[model samples]
Target: MSLKQSPCKDEIIAEAKRLGFYKIGFAKVRSVEKASASQYADWISVGCHGEMSYLDRYHDVRNNPQQLLPSAKTIIVCAASYYPAKKQSIELPQIATYALGRDYHEVLRERLMLLADFVGGETRVCVDTAPLRERYWAVQAGVGFVGRNSQLIIPDAGSYFFLGEILTSIEFPADTPLTQSCLECGRCVDSCPGNAIIGNGAIDARRCLSYLTIEYKGDFPEGFSLGNRLYGCDECQAVCPHNSTPIFTSIPDFEPSDELLSLDKKTISELTPELFSMIFRHSAIKRTKLMGLLRNLKALD
Candidate 1:
């Protein structure tokens, strides 16, 4: 049965706020062929995707939301702030701030599912797991502007957040896109230790520390040192001027666990598969698996 369309955009936004999402917006599910795709294609063509073969699996579906859900009328884009004011101890083997808490995939998927249930229609919740171009959807939905570093930078909230989406047959109003672009501010580009940020909105994921530390399964590239990173690297985001002023997150689910924040090299090196599962069973770190994590630790040494 075709569901009758209603203007529930305001309600959806309100519920999103009540659910603790920092921001919510909407956009029409349409074909996108921006430079983003071309750049991604170039990256994939050169094998920059490394061992992440899933990225190459759904090229058409990932590029176009309509392909994922033909009947989908709107895309609900949401961002949840994961920023922590206090930095983790440098002596510890660092995990990304996003992984310090409950797995964002689980936390965000649950919230997005509730939204879908509230709307009551054919809908799907997509966190980081999906093939969708999440940042593009977020910008199209008017949640924030893509910065020079290619991270979505909200005016008030900065880039220390996660983006998620819900594709549904319901249409909603979208917010206005940000008018001010990064004014040739090369802070992020200049600050990138791995020199990943090439230019405005361009990133060589192959050289990106985050990609190397978390996504790549093999040994670290020649001359590239993992240092203290045990999970994901946030050096680029940490150095962005927009992210300079620490944004405190109120979501308890996002708070870093004491064990996660205090994990030392000794702990990580000695972590068995069973211990790894026990500690990160509810965290996104599980994505790397025990062997993958050990591989990352070895790179750091």
Candidate 2:
């Protein structure tokens, strides 16, 4: 990769801000050779990842970005706020705050592509779907540290956000990791109704409500209660001290639709295939599929 024509990290950061990203940081491509890597191995070994077999399949690429993009020299990590002051009523089955708005994958992709173009050369934009260790990179970039909940917590902006990244051949100065780590208050663990937080920055996915509601494809484990969640769970994040200040998103694309914010359990239970398709057309909720959603709703019964 030629350095003469490539833009600097600062210039890319400026572009990222102009595009409305809440937090941005850059890091040089490197192997994951630390406690986090070992923790991942342990998590898998203990079956903490549960039914997510993709985690096993992409183990190599997830640890080393060199495998994802051989020529990539730098990674630009970014976060966008998704917190909204208005929340769904208690009468309704809850949806995770991140999914309350339009699909973040789509929202982040458009803006990340713009930043990637500015960086020049070969580039890859990754949201959550990629096997990349996104939260690990977020910390390496100094944007934030990984909380016990296993989510990236930006000090000022909170944990209610989406993470995105740009992998490119262009080189840039890497930011130092932040000194700030989670407060270690154990709030997330105590607050989790499903008892999913198993300590050491790992979660028992079989008992995780979020994983059960969205990712796990098999039968709803008997005796596991969903606690009024129609789609995803946010009990752990809702109690985080870092998220108390409520740094709301300014991006229009992240704003929630009226139907999504007002949806009650009755509405969800009554949803027809056509209505579900039309309402969640481009939303991340589509990932669960209409039948999966109805199955989740049935658990609420």
Q: Which model scores highest in lDDT?
A: 2
Clashing residue pairs found in predicted model 2: none
Model 2: per-residue Cα lDDT over 157-199, one tens digit each: 7899899999988788899988687999999999897889987
For candidate 2, which ten residues in a row score worst on lDDT? 1-10
Model 1 C-alpha lDDT per residue in residues 1-301, reported as the tens digit of each score = 7565553888888888788788888888887766778888877787766667888888888889888888898999989888765558887778877778888888888988987877667788899887899988888888888888888888766888888899997766656655567545687777776788766586777887777777777765566567777788777777777776756776788887788777877888898888989999999888888888888877774
Candidate 1's C-alpha lDDT? 0.80
Candidate 1: worst 10 consecutive residues by lDDT?
Answer: 175-184
What are the TM-scores, per candidate, against the unseen true structure? 0.91, 0.94
* Candidate 1: pairs in clash: none
